[model samples]
Target: MLGVLSAMLCCGAVSAQQHEVEMIPFGNMDQWIDRQIKESGIIGGATKNVYAIGPTATVTETKAYKNMGGSPWATSNVMARVAGITKTNTSVFPEKRGDGFCARMDTRMESVKVFGIVDITVLAAGSMFLGEVHEPIKGTKNPQKMLNSGIPFTKKPIAIQFDYKVKMSDREKRIRATGFSRITDVEGKDFPEVNLFLQKRWEDEKGNIYAKRVGTMVVRYYTTTDWHNNATYSIMYGDITGDPAYKAHMMRLQVEERYAVNSKGESVPIKEVAWGTEDDVPTHLLLQFTSSHGGAYIGSPGNSLWIDNVKLVY
Candidate 1:
């Protein structure tokens, strides 16, 4: 579902007609499968090694997952993995659109009463990414890496556009550190986000990693700013806005930060370059979307998001 052309041109003067590039197949939610979990084995009268099936989302034309080194995003069902003692769940389903369908994500909460009653809220989101899923390894921390080596992309895109809808709950909530110690505020407002990353990178003979970010585009809404249905948003190149942690990861590339140090031993600030420039050899292209703002931790339950008709206009 990745190609370049122009068909639906709007809102801008164009020298010639440009066809829209479909980066994700099944983006319209015309196809899906039921949620299934398999038991790998059993241990001491308890179910153990439960994992979700692969290829959750499909591309209508091309074999995107098999051909693209197992694309890491799941749309049909939220793939939640246990991190330490916390279990994360993000449930997704297909909702009827005008004629076809769109992906819908919902947030819910679960309570555990083993030692003491503890309520864990899960903010589900529809997401796609570049990585694999595996069980947490013993003696290892954060066994799964979020980003894998991305697919080969050489073209410079003008904008990333998509259709989305969001509905937030009215009840506000918060998470406490101990029983009554308030630490983080979990507000009623939630959001959906989309991102695109283009990079020129490679590895050395000594297994050292190196990369230069060529371009990126990010669109995120943390509040109930735009809650209309089928709202079209075209994120132009260089339109980057997010939290400081998100911005720092975009600037440093996360491969290595020491490489950007100046002569005074201070890290030099790296800026985001223009899109589609033929300055660096293109090595990777990563695109991801998420519906929840607090997937790293617990979030507000009952928040919902819908998305469809994603395109890359060039």
Candidate 2:
């Protein structure tokens, strides 16, 4: 029953539109979160289930064009054609400081003509400087955009993107960092929490740098969106450690666990959501959760997140 997608669903569960929606058995993250925080003396309320978390992005495939000559920094060394150090492709490609940085990739595996593309200059602080180019880029590196800045850890998982934000407001004296934690429960019993903390970080230098941060955004969870298909890029990932007071009660009882999904779009039990699902996704993956689903997210309105470090146990 570990990786099985078959769950006894709720016959009457409906969607937000009130149309009859399918409610699969929520993987037991609810009780898991409750049990984890039970001793904290906070009223652990049940929030809406999480859907997509991440491996924020994926590397499919690209073409191998000509390697021109500009950057002496990129492509200086060589090794396994599949993976190598960052600068290998920087010299020839269009670079924005560093547009797209990549390593340890297999273009053949991705089934593309090229390798990978990235916008590595995201980490740079100022407008007129070269940060770190992932591949050959054109023009000055433009700041990248993101669809979602996912959460850090959960019963599910997602790769935190550049747009993710952490905010502190007076409406409630809480600080919410997206994708910071996850919840899990089984048959109403809470599971042990596999927590993730924003343990480390480095500030970018004023000149061309490796990373950048916005005012309200948590620097740890996001990376600038400077990427292209078939190019390579390298960046860092980290977590955020803080608090956004949940409704009524908040405690550590919130633990996280996983349920497996099948080839079909079958639902997982325990009120969790799928943050990420795609053709590139492996056959087996965990049911992830996060605070990033802005409006209907559980607990506080703006206190939601997109979970990170997501993995399912077979």
Candidate 3:
């Protein structure tokens, strides 16, 4: 299923400075091991698999750690009941690194016989982010909710960088292109996605969402990289709605050519430099990490993503 993360932040302004930002609490994964053992099992609440998608599932999810010193990071205990066996500890962990730690997100593949007849393979991916996870609601088209609960950030950053390593268990490369969608199925190991959204947003009394784009980055890592930015990042403009050619796509990449990523890992579009101007105030930042490419669907098991040292460079 889709692992959505919600980020929320109050409106404010940050001074302009060339500083290394520590936006994510416990970014080093130092206390994650202890948190895992103590806060594991059932921290938030339990979920029932009424859809009968597979394995007659019931998931015990972790509660969102919202009040942990204004930090919004959270973990879910993704366990499933398959054939009456209670499965526990299926997602989110801190793996040991060289005297430090790295957060590892993984996916599990499950084979279940639906209706006691056809066998179906399902993929379940673990995710981590700076937001809240809303459980799925029955009788609705919504699979799950990972709404943007952002923080008031004002400083303009040159780039967001981190260290990452990927490992895949399956050898199936080359995913077929579904259809009209240009997103052709490609081969390789499993795919993991990292995205950040910095925007000037607000909600009225009626909760109507309105926002002005600031900056963003969408990344897919293949090889392990050490502190690199702009290689695959794009910053957004203040408003992209007026563009007649703007066609909405996945992740709301609706801006026409107002923004673009540098192929050589350097400057973004000149128009993007207009982000975070005096007019655009009370911005909110959202960043998320996941080990799967598909939306609300299981992926190949044994796909692992190790992330470390996420920081913002201003």
**Number of the top candidate by lDDT?**
3
* lDDT for each residue of candidate 1 in 133-212, tens digit (9 for 90 to 100): 33222212221232243456776765555677776656566332221233466654555566667766555454444556
Those runs of model 2 whose alpha carbons end farther than 4 Å from true positions after fitting are: 1-165, 173-259, 263-265, 270-289, 292-297, 304-314
Evaluate model 2: give its lDDT.
Answer: 0.18
Q: Compose the digit string of candidate 2's lDDT tens values, residues 196-308.
A: 21111111232211111100111121221222221111111121113221111211111222111222422222212221222122222112122211111112222212111
Ordering by TM-score: 1, 3, 2
Candidate 3 local lDDT, residue 147: 31
By lDDT, the better pick of 1 and 3 is 3
Q: Is candidate 2 or candidate 3 better by lDDT?
A: 3
At residue 114, candidate 1 shows an lDDT of: 31
- Stretch of 10 with least lDDT, candidate 2: 122-131
Question: Could you tell me the C-alpha RMSD of candidate 3 in Å?
Answer: 13.1
Off by over 4 Å in 3: 1-23, 33-67, 76-89, 110-122, 134-141, 146-149, 169-190, 223-251, 254-279
Candidate 3 backbone clash number: 16
Better-scoring candidate (TM-score), 2 or 3: 3
